[model samples]
Target: MRFFALVAASVMLLAVAAAAAEYNVVDYGARPGGRADDSAEAFLAAWAAACNDSSSPVMRVPAGTFLVSQAYFKGPCRSAAGVVLAVDGVVVAPSAVDSSAWIMFHYAHGLKIRGGTLDGNGHAYWACKSKTTPGRRCPHGTTTLDISQSRGVSVRRLTLVNSKNAHMAIFDCTDVTLRGVKMLAPRDSPNTDGVHVQLSTDVRILSATIRTGDDCVSLGPGTSDVVIRNIKCGPGHGISIGSLGGEAGEAPVRNVTVEAAELTGTQNGLRIKTWGKPHPGLVESVTFAGVTMRGVQNPIVFDQSYCPGRGNVNCPGKSSGVKISDVKFTDIQGTSATPVAVRFDCSSTNPCTGIMLNNVNLTYNGKQAKSFCKNAHVRLLPRVAPRRATAYRPALPCQLESRPEIRLVGLRLPVLCLPVLRLPVLCSCYACPSRASPSARDRAGDPTAGPAPPSRSPHLLVYTHMLVIYFQDILGCGKFKKLGLQNEEALQKCFGDIISVGNDHWSPHMVHGAAAASPSNAPNVDGNDTQDIDIDLTQDKATCEEGDTNEVEQISPVNANGKRPPRPAPPKAKKQKSGTALTIQEAVTSMATSATSYASTKQGKYSIDEVMEHVIACGATYETNEHFIASELFVKKEQREMFMTFRNNEVRFSWLTRKYMAKYGN
Candidate 1:
């Protein structure tokens, strides 16, 4: 019994010793030198032994500079406890390498890489490319460290420098964490991105300091649930989501959070760029918060029309189709190197929607910065400092400007300038002296005729004539004549080449006789009385006669002298009762059906108020309602006014409604 116990104790001790095995590269004939010997074989041998060990194995590189050439550490190791690659020395890549990656871990799982300095030695490659002619291409060189098709990977406390391309790339991996990783490259080093993550999930990059020419951290397509925090980036293109949409059927990138990042003197801080081509991919639910930018050229940017080739030789003229929505930029305060600090040059086809800017204070040269938005629906939360320029040019006759003093039901409203409709109604009573009769001219001199009709301003008349000619081309000559405008030749001469007359169906002589003989104008032409013209601009000339005259008399009261009394102020709209609003799903479903029915019957034409009510009924949430309207409905050129109206009213919707509409309505 005593002899058996001694043998068992010896076996247990041996097993314990095997469990903590270590494989050293030096033991595998690795020499420390710049040119004496290549250490790639020795490092591979060490990794092979460590990986096959059933124990918790570690492959170690001691305190020396080892030169390697395109080493690949392939995995599916026998070690159940995983393998650790710990280096206390420097691993240097040869100046002239052919492979795309200097050191790559392929299909590696449960891998931990800690405490290494990787020197890419990329100066030669960069210099070679710089000397190459524009038409010619040079060797693209390699990424420093790449981990592909791996899982449960942790890279910590590593310093990577001077990479020919990206310093570190995480591709097609899952459950990866990079902590305390420092990457350094010259500011002028082309395409030296610090960390590039693509087709990966659950990636956490924390406490990283990156200085490079390209993006410090870039998240490509199919990347989701990424958390990037505590990053210090400078002299680089600050963290970017893309230059995506280069191909069709790309996967959507969603649920990315980047917070507590500081960017200094970078080309851009927090940018999402997509190519100007047709792509079905989208970027959604991205949050950039608590970011501090110092002298960044563009603090916040969504460049959907990204054409980066020299001379734009390969530029795609078509608008981008990638949908970017529900992106929030919060608590971003900094100084901008350029005056336009915040730029949203989104795609005209798939305009960036549901963009919220909250508590963003960006300054340009110690003064207020400006924001430029094109085809982007931006919602400014309280305390957004950068003032938006009139960059979003809507295809409408007049741009709506918000006038807080103009209230409807106690809500501040944007005042739409309907000068074409209002000017004719207000100035109709000012009869021409040549047209008016002698009695009407005498009545204009009477003090008791209230005040003589105010003389028309020459400038106003010219402006009105221009508007008439412009709308005449748009609404057709029939509608133009129905506006009761005279002196068609004068207006055509005044506008001359500026107005393109597309409608040749109606002759000016056809309307001139009617204008001269109309009973409504006879009294005004004779100048017998300064009576208000009761023309209903909203109705057609035929429909205007059908309108109740008694209702018009009640609305516009006339005195005994045949002069209209002072117009009564418009009645305030009653405040709506706070009834139980429908849930987002209910609102969207109801609105989808209603919009489809309305579109089928009316050719999708809607009044501004009708569109506003539709958006309101949809509950105004970007993800559910606003996105639906912007992307699915109101996207036609004829519906553009409705789109602009809803945007001016600050009504929002959702992008998810596309599918909902597809399922529930046309």
Candidate 2:
């Protein structure tokens, strides 16, 4: 009974703390319904009060349209349960443009922004920019919600629309979760990326429906462990890893997975793009699985030679050095607007490796799909597009010696040695029988020869074996003739420099005296048609000390294995083939003419015209509704509008015309 009383008392104290922590904007002099001096200040004051409370706090904004100007809710809250900004009200942005963010949540932990409409009045800025001709400039507005440098933050059930720039920019944060977020913008709006995550990790975006001009979910440099699931993105550039490696000293994006996504009428899908400049970073372990695309222009691509804003003028042909490896695309069934279903344009200097395409069935124009690859090692499963895929195999395995020999101590009696090429030691031996009557080789050679007693020579007791090692390649450094090491002196120097351990307690056989054989005229294994072979050793040299006898002499051709050392097989030669080798001018001309002229030749049921019409129709329904509502307010000749009277006794109008009428005249 005493323990039950203690539990009840603790529960009562928690309830009392929760009640004391509640701060409502109505009690703080907030006037909703489009008041000029709106609830922006009052809402901020309530957030401050609730954030300072020791218990879990709730700052509630009741259901009403609250006109707010640039407000920032800053926090390092004292609440253990964090501060919940339970906003059921529609927070509308002011028409007065500023360089500051419309709404920013900065430095907050355990923060939750939920249940509201964040309306950025971007129509005015879009109109001002639209009216500007050449040489005329218009000031652009800021992002809708700039949440930066906060950990353990969640923004849920929020409708963010008409952002001046990116809708929600999550920067330099960790453990951010955004669920059931709807980001809406015009398809033609410039630079309105939906959810941009940069310099952040462990970000999860679930059940998001994004319609915008730019990428739906863009992961910039230094982003990793990002999971995007159940996303429906359309009328935008689809999810992208980067336009990375644009500048020097940039961090790489790694371990990003986007699964169960449906992209309709998107410009691109599942893309990883790096700039044409050089960056010494790496993008690794990215997976795009269970993605469905409807009329996506480029369904899968890895463009290491990406130059976004700059067109094909003076492209320099310089590729990014950011090594992208271990990327996977699985279960991606889609239709591409263009004939090229998948393109992998990797770097020349830093070629991409370990790219896997599994169960990818993309079609173009009702015909079997095709792909284009450049400087990347790609593995494709049978279900992938282009049923007849000639997979990329490396031209050379490893620079190995043709005839490798090792030194072993010899006993007077022959010992049986088995071939151990695949073993670590490379040679194995067994003790010979001591009771043999005659020499085994002589007895086997002559039928008339009788068995003789085995000679017990004490001199054949034992010999000290010295370990001599030889290796063709270690790590990536080897003798490639293209690097200009051809002479005997250069070969010796290369061996001594490259194949050495830290200590000199042992001597490597190949390092001191080994000569490369004359390279065959046959082509090497690298996919290119080059005739030059890198490292091919033919001879081995072993030295014996003075006390070593004739039986245990160095450089013997035969061993106990009784098998002759086999020569290394020559690399199979293959010619590098390019299906589409056109210059930029030709590509541009082809793109312009391909739509009209190429449509007639398409064997598919839907023509290019039909595909484009379908793509445009995908976004027209929502865009049309938004345009219809926006046209009534942003008219050149405006009539009277309904004005709302706030509790602060301020009568305010809710349209762009309201600001225009107060400034100009009707």
Candidate 3:
């Protein structure tokens, strides 16, 4: 038994030693010291041996210069544990290699590449494409390192210089980390991006230094949840989010953050660009914070109509359809190489919105910089050093304008145009009435002639009653009922008279008769009860007769005997305790509840259009241009929070208005 046990122990120890194996390139016939002989085969042989190990394996390249050409490492290795490529030497790519990438790793899992220098020998390739070098067809230069279709990958302390194209590319990958990496190339190198990330997520780049001609870091379509911190970039186009929308059906880019970056003498500090073509993609929830720019040109930009070549030759003139929103630039202090420090050249068809700037200070040649904007909705918080252009204004709340006149219950009151509904509303509190004295025709032997308009003083209650009748009869009370505004008694108490007319017509004689019958039920205005006043119908009748000819049909509430008819009985009021004014939170809650209830009737979902309808029904008032209602809502903290929370829990309704969805939707 002792002899058998000793033999089993020896076998187990040998198996363990075989599992943790190391394969050296020199042992596999790799010639070092920058040999003319191709070393790609030796490196591949070493990788194949190491990858076949069932446990942790390391493939080492010893301390010497080696020459390789177009090496490809493909894997789903036998090892369940990780595979490591440890290089203590320099790898040089031969000149004139006709491949897309100098080195590529595809379908590799749990791969770690540590400590190496890769030289791409791109000087001849660059010179061949120069204008001075005539009649020379340039071969498509290769990227230095390309990793695709892999996960759990990390590259540390790697130095890549003079790549023909992009230095390093992370494509269709996840959970990737590139730290302590350095990429260097000439400032005039064509199309040599330092790092490019495309169709990837959960990518982190920390403590990287890049100097190149193209973008230091470029994020392509379908890239999200990326965090880039402590980057030192110069002599290149700075970080960019696109050149997207080049094709239809492209995915959106979202949730990206570039923080603690120092950009010196770059072409642009931060930029987002899209082609002038049709695409349904969108960008949102991105932040660029704590960035310091030194003499950067165009420190901030959003160019939706991007055309890459010189003079924008052969570029399409159509507007871009990619929507961009919810982007913030905070604590960005910079010096601009040009006078215009910030520019927003957004698409006219799909305007950029919900952009916020906080504590951004940019100077142009030691003076306050200038800004330019077109088709963008920007919110400038306090401490913005250079104010926006005169043509642009900070996004403000929506303002209901009084441009049309509405005839309600024989009173011609100015109507407010509700932006959400695009319809005229007869509410009295939203707009000041035309207080001009009654016309000569109205004053000619009219007993109802008075200095105060129907929207003010003793007649305000009557005007409000007219509004309730208009809403109930003309606008369909069932719709308003769903919004929690169909409570006749509550609306009356909140505004004026509590009158419910079942039909589409109201008469001044009915109001006078009701006041005459029940004096205590009348509203009190200016220290006097409305019941004590003698209401007249002559001016009301004349005003209605002389109103616009295109008004909606109205039925008179007068009998054939020229006498006022009795008012119809109002709806039975619900028995509820009276409450004090609501706090902001309570108001928002009430609005959300009403919106949810209304949405349930539609399809178990709600949108900004539906919400805005409810807001109008609840008598919410704002102040701004009519085109900015959705933007204003997103700018207000309480409303945005409520909407975001509501959207997260419920199914989103996609049939919202295009304008609202483009600016505020996810």
On residues 221-244, what C-alpha lDDT tens digit does candidate 1 reach at each position?
778999999999998989899867
Runs in model 3 lying further than 4 Å from the true structure: 1-20, 132-134, 309-315, 384-666
lDDT of 2 at 510: 6
TM-score for predicted model 2 compared with the true structure: 0.56
Candidate 2 has which clashing residue pairs, if any?
A: 395-525, 395-526, 396-525, 396-526, 417-560, 437-452, 438-452
The list of candidate 1 runs beyond 4 A from truth reads 1-20, 132-137, 310-316, 384-666
Which regions of candidate 2 fall more than 4 Å away from where they truly are?
1-16, 308-316, 384-666
Q: What digit string (tens of lDDT, one per residue) describes model 2 on residues 524-572? A: 5576665655653432223342333456534537667986566566678
Give the Cα lDDT of each candidate.
0.66, 0.61, 0.65
Candidate 3 weakest ten by summed lDDT: 506-515
The clash count for each model shown is 13, 7, 1
Worst window of 10 by summed lDDT in candidate 1? 506-515
**What is candidate 3's lDDT per residue for 258-296, written digit by digit as tens?**
999999999888999887776667999999999999999
